[model samples]
Target: MDYVFGFIGAGNMATAIIKGLVGNSVVEPDKICVCDVDMDKAQHLSTEIGIEVVSEAEKLAEMCHIIVLAVKPQNYAEVLEQIKGTMTEEKVIVSIAAGISINYVREQLGMKCPVVRVMPNTPLLLGKGATAICPSENVSTRDFGIVKSMFSLNGTAEVVEEKHMNSIISVNGSSPAYIYMFAKAVVEYAKSQGIDENTALKLFCATLEGSAAMLMESGDDPDTLIGKVCSKGGTTIEAVNKLNENNFCETIKEAMDACTKRAEELGK
Candidate 1:
C-alpha cells in the first residue's frame, strides 16, 4: 500500500487513475511516476497531477514497485520489451490494455512476472468506474488486495478468472461507448422533436444515473423493473414493442459476440 506507482502511458486513462489515486489519497503524488512516448505529455501530467515524470518506461519500472501499462494494445510489445528486464518478481504490472492477457504479457516479459489485467471503464474519471481485475498466478494475495484497493480509489473493482477477462472487455470496458451511442441517439431524437439540446442532455444523463442506481439498490431483476414500468397498453410498452420488432436485444447480443471475438483475437 505504501509502494510507488508508475504509469507507462500518461494519456487519458492514465490521467484518470492518477487523479483518483492522488485525489483519494490512495497514494501521494510524489510517489506516483509517469512516462510517455511524448515528454510533453509526461510533463503535463507531472504538472497537473504532481506526479514524478520519467523519460523511459524502464526508468519508471525501476523506480516504482507498481507499474501500470496504460499504453495502447499495439504499443504493448515495445513498452514491455523496454521494461522487461526491470520487472522484478516483486514488481506488479497492472495492464489496462484491452485484450492483453496475463500469460501473453509474461511471455513478452520473458519471466513469470506479477501481472494484473484490468478492464476499467472511462467513467473512472468521475470515480465511478466498473473495473475488473484478473491476476496471473504469480500475483500474491497481497498483490490482489493492493491492486483492488488502489482501483477502489476510482470506483468498484471485482476479481474474476482470467478466462473471463476478455469477456469483461465487452461487459464494462467497451459498454460505455455503447451507452454513449444510445444517449447520443436519444438526445438527437429529442432535439429533432424541438427539445433544447442542453435540456435533453441533462435529462437523459440523469435518467441514466438514476436508472443505474435503482438497478443497484432495488434488489430486483431488470425484467421485473421493466414490467413495473410497462402497463398493458402504455407508452413504455409501445416503445418496448418497437424495440422488440427491431430486434434490439438480438442486436446487442450480436455486438457483444463480435466484441468478445475480437478480444479473443487480440489475445492471440
Candidate 2:
C-alpha cells in the first residue's frame, strides 16, 4: 500500500497522469518514479513534477507497487525485456499504450502477470480525461479496483470488456483529435469572414463548451436541440444546410470507422 507508481515512459500522457495523481493527493510526489531511455526526458519530469528518476528499469520495477507502461506500443517489447527481471506476483502492470492488450502484456512478461489495459485520452492533461480499462483474467477484483482508482485520480475511469476496448478507442481516445479538427475549422472560417483570430478562437471555444454543457444539462435529445437552433429559415438552418450538403455526418462516421479499424489492426 505504498501506492508507488513507476512510469517506463516519461512522455506527455505519463506526465499528465503523474501530475494528476499528485494534484489529487492520490500518491505523494516522492513515491512516484520514472525511468526512460532518454535520460534528459526522465530528468526533466523528475525535476518538473518532483518525481524520482531512476537510471535502471529494474530498479523502477522492483521498487514500485504499480508499474505503468506509458510508452508507445512499438516500445512495449523493449521495455518488457528490460523489466522482465523485476516481475513479481505482488507487482501490477497497468499499460496506457494505445492498442496494447492485457494478454499481450502477460505474453511479453512470460508469466501470469496481472495486467490492465487502459486507453486514456489527452484531456487527462487537463484533469477531464476519459479512460477505459480492461484487466487480464489473472487480476483479482481488489487489484483491479486499485488500478482503476489510480486512473480515476485524474479523470473518469470505467472498467469495460476487453473486446470493446478497440471500439471505445474511436468513441473517446481519438475523438478529441476529431473534435479539435472541427474546432479548428470553425476558427478558420471565422477568420475567413474577417474576424480577429483571437476573438474567433474565444467565441468558437466557448460555443463548444456551452454546447457540451447543454447536452449534459438539458433533458431533450441532441437532434431536438439542433432543431431548436435551426428554427425555420434561420441563419443556423443555412449553416446546417451547407453541412448536410457536405455530408458532414457521414464524414464523421467514416473518420471514426477508420480510427477503430486502425486500433483493431494494432492489437493484432
Candidate 3:
C-alpha cells in the first residue's frame, strides 16, 4: 500500500510499533515518518528504522496518511492542538496514550476525523502483547480494519466498546505486572527451598507457558483444569487449600478493580 504513517513521539511504544511495521514489511520505511521534541532521539530512531524524521509535529501530520499519537496522556491535548489543522478527513489518527478518550481527542482536534484509541502494554516489544482497540464514529470499517491489521502484525488485537477500555487495561495492560510479581514470588520461594535462581526461573516460566498453552488448546474451563490438577488429599489440593485460605482470588479481584478505578481517574 502506498500509505504514510507518522508518529508524534519516539518513545519505546512508538519505537516498537515502527519496528513492527518496518520489520514485517507492513509499510515501507520511506513511507513512515516520526516527530519528537528530542531531535536526537528522533534522528536515532529514523536512522535505525530507515524512516523519515521531522522535528515538527505539524510537518509529520501534513505528510502522513495515518498519524499515531504516541505521547504521554498529559501531553495529548497540546499535541492534538498542535496538529489539529494539519489533519484531513482522509487521515486516520490512532492514539496509544493510556487513559485518553476518543471524545477528548476529537474535541481537542475540533473535527470529525477518524480516531482510534488503543491500549497496548510494554509486552508489545516481544510481539506477544494484547491490545484493545476502540474506534470513533467517524472511522469507517476499512479504516478500522487497516488499523487493527497493523497492530495484529505485532500482537493480538480486539475491538471493543470504548466503555470497556478501562477494564481491558486492568485485565491485559496492567496484568503483566501482576504476572511478573507472581513469578518473582515463585522464584524467591524456590530459592528459599535451596533451589538455584536460574533453575527456579526456568521451571516457573515453563509452568506458566505450559499452563497458558493448555488453556488455549484444551478449551477447558480454568476451574475444571484446576480441579483436574488437584486430586483429593494430594499435594496440589494442599496448595489449593492454602491459596483459598489466603483468599487469593478475592485479592486478585480487588487489585483489578483498583486498577480499573485508577484508569478511570486518569482518563477523567
Candidate 4:
C-alpha cells in the first residue's frame, strides 16, 4: 500500500497497469516511476499521468520497492541484467512478460529476491483485463497479496500455480483476439446480407457483451444457454446444427491447443 512502484517499460501494458493504479487511487501518481529506452514514451506517461520518469532502469529499480518488468520477453535479458545488481530481497519483482517464468527471472537475477509473474491481457487497458498471478517461493505472502490486489484493481485477478501460467495464455491472455475474429466473421456475414457495416458491427458487439453477461449472471451452463436460444425446430437450432456439423467446437479446441503449444515454446 505504501510502496513506490517502478515500471521498466513504457509500453501499452505498463501504461495500462500504471493508469489503473493511479486512476483507481490505489497508488499515488507521484509514487510511481517509469523508465524506458524511449524517453519520449516515458515522458509521455509522466506528462499525462503525473508519474516520475527515471533516466535509467537501474535508477528506477533502486528507487522503487516494487519493480515491474513490463518489458518485452526478448528485452528481458538486457533489462534484468541492468537492474539485477540493484535488486535486493526486500524489493519485489513483478514481471508481465509473456512466456517468461518465475524461475527464469530468478535465474537471470541470480538471487532469491521475491518474484511475481503475471499474465495480463490487453483489456486491462480498458480496466476489464484478466490477469493470472503466480509468485515464486521466495515471495512473501504479504507481497503476493499486494501484487494480486494491484492487478485485481485493474481487472479480474486470480492466483494460479506456475505450471498453469502457460496454459492460461489460451484462456484469457490471447482470448480477446479469438473473440474479435469471431465477431469479424459475424459482422462480415451480416454485411454480406445487406446489413449496414457499422450497424452489423455494433449489434454483434453488443450481442457479445450481452452473451458474456448472461453466461456470468444467468447462472446457466453454456450448453443450457445454447438450448435456450435454440428452440425445438427454430432458425437458431439450424445455425447451431450447421456450426456443430462443421466441427466448430473441435476447431476451437485445436486453436486453443495451438495457442498453448506456442506459449510453451516461447517459455523454452
Candidate 5:
C-alpha cells in the first residue's frame, strides 16, 4: 500500500495502535510516520518500530494519507490549528483524544476534510479493546471503513452516534478500571481468609474469565445465569444474598453513572 499513516503523538495509545497495525501486517513500518514534541521519544519509537520520525507536525501531515491525533485533549486545539491549513481533502484525520469533539476538529480544520473520532480504552495495549467510532458528516463511507479497519487491528470497533460516545466511555472505556477494582477486592478478601496472594490472584482471574466467557457463549440474561448458579439453600445463593444485602449492584450502577457524567463533562 502506498498510503502513509501519521501519528502526532507517540505515547502509549499511539504505540499500541502502531504496534497493532504493524504486527497485524495492516501497514508496513515504512508507511508509518510519527511526530512528537519530544524528539528523542519520537526517535526512539522510530528506531524500535522502523517508521520515520519527523520533528514538525506539518511535516508529518504533509506526508501521510491518514493522520491520527493521539495527543491529549488539552493539546488537541493547538495541534489542529497547526495543521488546519495544510490538511487536504485526500487526508483523513482520526482523533483518539478524550473529550475533543468532532465539531471542534471540524471547525479547526475549516470543516472541509473528513474527521473521525474514536474512544479506545487502555486494554488496546493487549489487543482486546472495545472502541466506539463516530464519523463526522464530511466523512465518506469509504473513509469510515478505512478508519474502522485501522482500529479493528487492536480490537472490535463499532460505529455509533456521537451522542452515545459518553455512554460508551462509561461502559467500555472506564469499565476496565472498575473490573480491576473488583478483582483487587476479591483478592484482598481471599487473603484475609488465609489464601496466598498468587493463589488468590489466579482464582480471581480464572473466575472472572470463566464468567465472562459464559456470558458471551450462552447469550443468557445475567440474572438468569446467576440464578442457574445459585440454587435455593446453596452456598452460591448465600454469597449472592450477602452481595445483595450490601447493595453491590446499586453501588456499581452509581459508579458507572459517575463515569458517564465525567465523560460528558470532559467532552464539554
Candidate 6:
C-alpha cells in the first residue's frame, strides 16, 4: 500500500480496476485516489468504494506514485498535458486507453517516464477479463511485474509486443461485443422458432464455455475440431456449410481489419 494509485477517470473500467485493487487487498482504500470531470461520478466512487476524490487531474498526478490514465484515447493528450509538470521518471504511467501507444504517451507528457500500455476488455468488471500489456523500454522490470500482477486479479494478462498492440485490440479488447452479438442473434432465432428464450440462452452460454475449454484443452485445431463434430453431412456440417457459404470467416477477417484500422487512426 506504500505505492499510491491515482486514476484520472471514474468510468466503468476505472471503477472495475479500483475495485479489483481494493477488493483483492492489493491496495488499501486509502492508498487509492480518483478524479473525474463528472463530480457525481468521482463522489460516487468515493462514497461507495471508500476511496479519496481529488479535485483535479493535476492534483491526482502530483499525489500518486502509480498514475493510471483511464480516460478515453482522445482525452489522453489533454490529461497528459495537464499532468506533464507532475510526471517524473520515477512515477509509472499505466494507460488503459485503446489505440494509445506508450511512445505517444511519453511524447505527450514530454517525459521519458515508464509507460505501460494495456488493452483490457469490459469483462474486467466481472473479474474475468483478458488484458494485453506492453511497456516502454524505460519501464523497470519491477514496475512491469506489478502491472502484470495487478491485472491477473481480474483475469489473464499477457505481455505482447508494442507492434502488435493495435492488432491485439480486435482479439481481446473488442471481441466481447462480437460474442454478445453472435449470442443475441442465436437467441433471436431460438425465440422465432418458439423456443423458450431463457433456456436457449442458458444452453448457448454453457456451450460457449465448453467450446472455449475444448479449444484450449483439446490438441486438435479449430478445423480439426469442426471436422470431429461435423459428422459428414450432419446438422452441424449443414450449419457450418451455410456459414462458410456466406463467407463467415472472410467477414470476421474484414471486421478485424476494420477494428485494427480504427485503432491505427486513433493512435495517429
Return the top candidate by lDDT: 6
Clash pairs detected, candidate 1: none
lDDT of 5 by residue, 95-168 (tens): 88766778778788885678898999998999988899999887888778777877787888888899887777
Better of 4 and 6 by lDDT: 6
Q: Write one digit per residue (lDDT tens) for candidate 1, span 1-268.
A: 3338988998888898888878878778988888888999899889887888888888888888889999988888999899987778788999898889988888998888889999998989888899998888878898678778777888999988888988888899999999999999999999999999999999999999999988999998999999988999889999999999999999998899899999888777
lDDT of each: 0.88, 0.86, 0.88, 0.88, 0.86, 0.91
TM-score of decoy 4 = 0.95
> What C-alpha lDDT does candidate 2 achieve relative to the native structure?
0.86
Worst 10 residues of 2 by lDDT: 1-10
Of models 2 and 3, which has the larger lDDT? 3
How much RMSD separates candidate 2 from the native structure?
1.8
- Candidate 5 residue 246 C-alpha distance from true site, Å: 2.9
Ten-residue region with minimum lDDT total, candidate 6: 1-10
TM-score for each model? 0.95, 0.93, 0.95, 0.95, 0.93, 0.98
Question: lDDT tens digits, residues 1-268, model 4?
Answer: 3337999999999999888888888779999999999999999999999999899988788889899988878888889999987888789999887789888888888988889999999999888899998988888888787788778988899989999998888899999999999988998898889999999888888898999999999999999999999998889999999999999999998998898888777667
Q: What local lDDT score does residue 172 receive in model 2, on the 0 to 100 scale?
A: 84
* Residue 148, model 2, lDDT: 84
